[model samples]
Target: MSHWKHVYEKWRSFEQLDPALKQELDKMADNEKELEDAFYTDLSFGTGGMRGELGPGTNRMNIYTVRKAVNGLADYLVAHVGDARDRGVAVAYDSRFKSQEFAIETAKVLGAYGIKAYVFDTLHPTPLLSFAVRYLKTAAGIMITASHNPPEYNGFKVYNDDGGQIVPDEAHQIIGCIQEVEDELTIPHLQKDELEAQDILNWIGKEIDRAYLDKLAEISKLATGEQQQDKDLQIVFTPLHGTAHDLVLRGLSQLNFHHVDVVEEQAAADPEFSTVKSPNPEEHQAFTMAIELGSQTNADVLIGTDPDADRLGVAAKDSSGHYTVLTGNQLGALMLDYILTHSVSNLPTKARMIKTIVTSELGRKIAADYGVETIDTLTGFKYIGEKIREFESTGETFMFGYEESYGYLIGDFTRDKDAVQAAVLACEMAYYWKRQGKTLFDALHSLYETYGYYLEDMSSLTLKGKEGAEKIAAIMETIRKEPLTEVGGLDVEYVEDYLAGERTVIGTKLKESIELPKENVVKYILGNDSWICLRPSGTEPKIKYYFGVCGSSAQEGQQRLADLKRDMEDVISRVHNV
Candidate 1:
């Protein structure tokens, strides 16, 4: 029999399988391809932790897989940290299907080892989970979510004692422990009642929520001596039917923003994300309902957040009274500008901004204009979070951190991308511009006029399952072996192979090593300072193309961006054919 067939029979023979998973397995018995995909390999547990479609497989986010992953975490903590049982993991979940169950499983797995678990009583945003780790003084944290993914997806993100996502070094250690497990299906876990009886299952909620909001409010005071008026600036918001609903509402109120309007249709805790095709705020289509509500209410700006509220999307009324959704890059620049301009008294000598390699250079330019240095890390919010901890220890001030995927952080209270804090700060920015008789759209155009028009965009191609994984690897290899000399009719000035940790000059052939940690990414810089980057998604079965170009005018910038995207898409298409 085939390898997958043997594994399938073995799984079917297990007696203690969950009833739902067992039924799913029995129903797909005749589907050979599905079975192979399910049993082909284990779900990846990288720096981002494990994420996949929810189903009954080692490669899925089922109870057994979650338990197995948690078993490794428990062991890693016990083997590495002293007094780990006393310093437990802070666990939180979003509104995704079975998120709560997975969170409970995580606690149970730890409890079986006599480790404490401080779990949130209800669904919460990912950032708050990070905050709870520090606020509750836990050893680590685990967030149950697949931020901005489709309804069928769920994930587990593990954070270290610093409350950021686990760095690669620690992730590898956990993986080593996970590989040592003899049988994931038979991993022993304490029952919920038993865990509570042992006093290792600690439930937390209102106190942490209040603490996060209070810290956010304390850090968001833009003008020191001002009482903060501008309540007339109308705003519309939608949480995209996820965990952010109640806390975001409370956060806005805490910030004293009274003219906020919400999209009731999408304001509830919904696991299916019924109103949209996908829950991601980065997509303009996800802002449709928010834009409608903003138009109806004649609001000055519209803000929408993904399920876990780690990523935020914004739309502002343009000159023609039409709401235009701003790109993540645009929002980042605006927020940086506002932070630097209004927080002069709060600025430290070493204040700086942090962004990923894939993010646009526009924000960097803006920070330069304000004299705040911009730092780049690999493309993950965890890296930015890690930097926050570094800045804390090094005495440098982390003014802001953001990614090009609608994730931003204004304060270091929460390590991950904080859409709730961003929402409040964005509202403050909108009002600041409103007070100047301008909109955020006006501010963006001003920024473009001052610092040449910078346009940014991203394209993602999803390739699923085992064959798709191999195809993605093949595509990456092909590109690395045979580099592109030019793109969009411009000469490739230099190529940065992050996997190889070197930047190669095209004409001189001189190579210099990159200082950042090595990652599987390649970036090509064009003659005109426009750049393109290609990398496989760490959390999803997708490859992404990031494009950025600067031009003397908006029309010219848009044209260049379009040409680059078209050329890159063609290249990807050619690879797909191969």
Candidate 2:
């Protein structure tokens, strides 16, 4: 029998399940299509951890699944240390359906395992939870957030003692424990009130928030009373109906940024994120309302954040006075440039910058211009976080880290991409530029002129269900067997096979070892500073292709990107046998 058949049979015989869950499972009986979609594969646990729709099926995310994961994590932690429970676990949730319930379930599972749980009293951003884990010296941390996914989607993100997501080796162990739990329903959990009574579960309140915000203030660039000349610069921002409503405005006010306009429609924390089709700031439609508000306020800059506020989107007034939504790469490069330029006094010569391998190479040039070194990690924020921990341990300075996905981090207080800190820095940079009688758009164009126009784009081809999984595997196999020697009429200069842990230069016999852990990813570097990478999403059922192009002019860069995208799509289609 297929995976779904087995899962359905097991679920049908399950006793003492919640009525809603039971009903959900019963509805799936004999519904091969839905059942297969839900149970064809296990929820993936990789570098970024797991994210999925919440339901009753084995593959779906639910209370029982949360408990299983937590129990597994508990086992892993206990094995790693004798007093694992004593170090405790910090838990937080964003404003989403069942987010609070899921967080509580995680805490209860830990509590049942005799582990202490420090649960946040209310919704908070993911970065704060990361910071809290390290600040409170917790053994681990958990954040219940779908992070810009639709309202129906939910997820569980696991963090290590260093406040970063569990790396591959640790993730493998956690996955093993999860698989060993033969009976999910039999997992132990403690009642909320009972857990508290035992003094092993503590409810954390505003004090933690205050402390986290205080640290944010330390890195803030607010000018002194008289030096706050840019206080009058008009700025508009929208949280897009997520958890950032109050925290962002509060941070801005604390930094003494006056004339800031918050979009009241998007201010309320709505789990559904009803105002926008998707919470992702990368989509131009996501910024429609914000753009309208920006025009009305004549704002110098506009900013938006995803549901958990871990990534930020930026829109700036261009020379034509029209607001343009900047791509993630553009925003990251602009932020990097601004930080390097303004923080020169505070920056040490040992400062280093980090970007994902797929991120624009313009950032590398900017770092070099500032006499700094730039390192490129894989295509995830966790890799960037790992680099941070590595550098900090070796006594190297971490100036900034960013990905092409609107995630950026400055200070090491948080080990993940921090929209909260990015927002603060964006506003401060806006102020600095405003004082110079220019907008961020002007600065971006200037950089582009000096460093050559760089363009990057991402596309994902999703395949769902059992057949979808098979198709994805076949695609990868075809790529391995018949690698493209050229794309868009450009010769492939280098190929990086992360799975093989080797980067090979074509024709010549040059090969270099990749220090990072191996993953199933393939990247091809073409001539003229153009490249493409293919990798399946660890948490979702999709294969994503990233394209990057650099040229002397914007039009040339765009044309090169378009051609590369077309060629890559052709390769994808052939792999899918479509």
Best by lDDT: 1
For all candidates in order, the CA lDDT equals 0.90, 0.86
Q: What would the C-alpha RMSD of candidate 1 be, to one decimal place?
A: 1.2
Model 1 bad stretches (over 4 Å): 224-230
Clashes found in each candidate (C-alpha, N, C closer than 3 A): 0, 0
What are the clashing pairs of model 1? none
The residue-level lDDT of candidate 2 at 526 comes to 95
Best by TM-score: 1
Q: What TM-score would every model get versus the actual structure?
A: 0.98, 0.97
Estimate, for each residue in 233-339, the C-alpha lDDT of model 1 and write its tens digit: 78999999987777777877766688888999999989999999888888888889998888788999899989998999999989899999998999999999888
After superposition on all CA atoms, what RMSD does each candidate show versus the true structure?
Answer: 1.2, 1.7
